[model samples]
Target: MPVLEVRRHTMRSKPGQHLSQQGVTLASLIGNSTGPFDLVWTSEKPRAIETAIAMGYTLTRQSAALGNLPKSILDAVAWPNDLESISKIVRRNNACERFARAQAEEWRSIAGELKDNQSALIVTHGAIIELGAIGFMPNATYSTWGDAIGYCEGFRFSQVEGLETCELLRVPSHLQLIHN
Candidate 1:
């Protein structure tokens, strides 16, 4: 089944933010869903929670398994070159690596709980989404600390034995739009 990894829509609080468009798009997508959703999940943050509510899903328990991220240990994250550095960093921190490992394990367990073809929506922070997805992929490995994460970007994967490596399905819909 396809997981609609929606980046939560805009917050009225942050007037004129890029995320507003993402929020609008998410609203459009959810409004268009004709089938029943098995579950809806969201981050503790108000923006994410409000987006989930607007999308019309009743709340499931919030997940620390999907919470705001701790920064990675690697130096400045630049990708390509930084990817190797990040992987090296993950190889260094026993605790951070452990967290990543645990997260993947939990997602595997969570996938089993869902009914076959059951549609579930998880409204969460971008870091958690990246940690849950890229941190769990195959052929790719990383340091437990210092993973470069961007906002509102995430992935989708089919559950086989465990949560498979995911493709980045969405990104923060707006950032430049956010103003103090």
Candidate 2:
């Protein structure tokens, strides 16, 4: 099976467009332990691109779809929602479902293109990751997923027999601590 690991960009100051110095360090640490991915993708946002580079991966692609959700969608769903809430919204909202489906298709297409034993990495934003995961695995138990993803947190998705599976990916607790 081919795997796709999708993560939000590393830390950035609120209202800032670029990665913070600590974000660079955190991404470097993450790179050391994870992936020699076959392909890497990012959002068009500088923070996303910088996270991939800091993780030492060559950029394979960038898409704005991974960066920003539409204003209408943003207005419809509250920010920082857990998977369960997002799932409910997806089921009830046509626009949300459409966006989620598109995200899932992009992930599937990327994963499908890879050979067996190969994997891809996508560094994107929070809501995009959550919606894509829910869209890809609608039957998954969302209540177990806890809160929404934070910086550098996301999911690992893989396909088997035309069905998709998702696993939450979290940065190590040690790496999450702020240094004085």
- List per-prediction Cα lDDT, in the order shown: 0.50, 0.85
Q: Which digits, one per residue and each the tens of the lDDT, describe model 2 over residues 91-177?
A: 999999998899888887778779988999999887888888888887899999978888888888877798777888888888768
Measured with C-alpha atoms, the lDDT of residue 91 in candidate 2 is 95
TM-score of each: 0.59, 0.92
The digit string of per-residue lDDT tens for model 1 on 48-89 reads 666666666677756655555556522222232333454444
- What value of lDDT does candidate 1 attain over all alpha carbons? 0.50
Ten contiguous residues minimizing lDDT sum, candidate 2: 171-180
Error of 2 at 164 (Å): 2.9
What's the lDDT for candidate 2?
0.85
lDDT accuracy of residue 50 in candidate 2: 96
